[model samples]
Target: VFELGDSVNQIDTKNESKNKSAIELLKVPKTVKNLKDIKKRKALANLEINSLAKLKALYLSLAENC
Candidate 1:
């Protein structure tokens, strides 16, 4: 569950629509193998993919909804 303070950053809390929207904005394929960029591939290989795109989208969604 999302905490009250978390909402200030637009973190979702079991909200299907918000999750869908965030994932769509990411434009990333379901599997890491589908990733094209070498950096992304390496990150995935290391299991360290911190997608700034997705984070931005989530923040935007939160800001919009807030």
Candidate 2:
């Protein structure tokens, strides 16, 4: 009975390690995708800011002329 219990425990441990590795593998791609999304959002925000700045400058020039 003790030997049987030990064998079961060893199998469970092996399965646990395999599951952990698989989970880690899955997480890596999600993490990379999240980083890519963050970078894209930052770039889009920068473009919007630049556009707003340009519009503001144009408005100021028009107001000065008027």
Candidate 3:
């Protein structure tokens, strides 16, 4: 009964997750942009989205640095 609840159901059956063979694109950064776009009419003082794009960009920069 997988009704989309917890981590156990999300784990793959063949145990390939441990090897990190599959990669799923992240959702948070895009979500932040979408939130900003939806409330664009508001004043900049009201902006409060935590942009993960910088974090991801940093990660990519470090990846190439190493």
Candidate 4:
């Protein structure tokens, strides 16, 4: 069911022991040198996913940031 980009960043494809599921993966950039930030990242992603408008807001927010 996944199209090109949909499958591009799926966490189900990651090793569970090494990566958070996509729902929580947004904050953990792969190159993070400070493990101390993981909790903060997860918390931020959880907050973003808590509501549809928040998710949409993040999507739009990231578009310009990118």
Over the stretch 18-40, how does candidate 2's per-residue lDDT look in tens digits?
45554454455447657776566
- Residues 1-66 of candidate 4 have per-residue lDDT tens digits of 222342213423322323344345555565646455666666654554354344445555676798
Top-scoring candidate (lDDT): 2
In candidate 3, list every pair of residues with a backbone clash.
Answer: none
lDDT of each: 0.47, 0.51, 0.34, 0.46
The predicted structure with the larger lDDT, 1 or 4, is 1
Q: Ranking under TM-score, best-scoring first?
A: 2, 4, 1, 3
Stretches of candidate 2 above 4 Å error? 1-30
The clash count for each model shown is 1, 0, 0, 0
Winner on lDDT between 1 and 2 is 2
- After aligning candidate 4 to the native by TM-score, how far in Å is the CA of 26 from where it should be? 10
N/CA/C clash count, model 3: 0
Each candidate structure's TM-score, on Cα atoms with residue i matched to residue i, is 0.28, 0.52, 0.26, 0.29
Off by over 4 Å in 4: 1-33, 53-66
Highest TM-score scorer: 2
- Tell me which of candidates 2 and 4 scores higher on TM-score: 2
Lowest lDDT block of 10, candidate 1 = 44-53
Evaluated at residue 9, the lDDT of candidate 2 is 46
Candidate 1: residue 20 lDDT (0-100): 53
Pairs of residues at least 3 apart in sequence or in different chains that clash in candidate 2: none
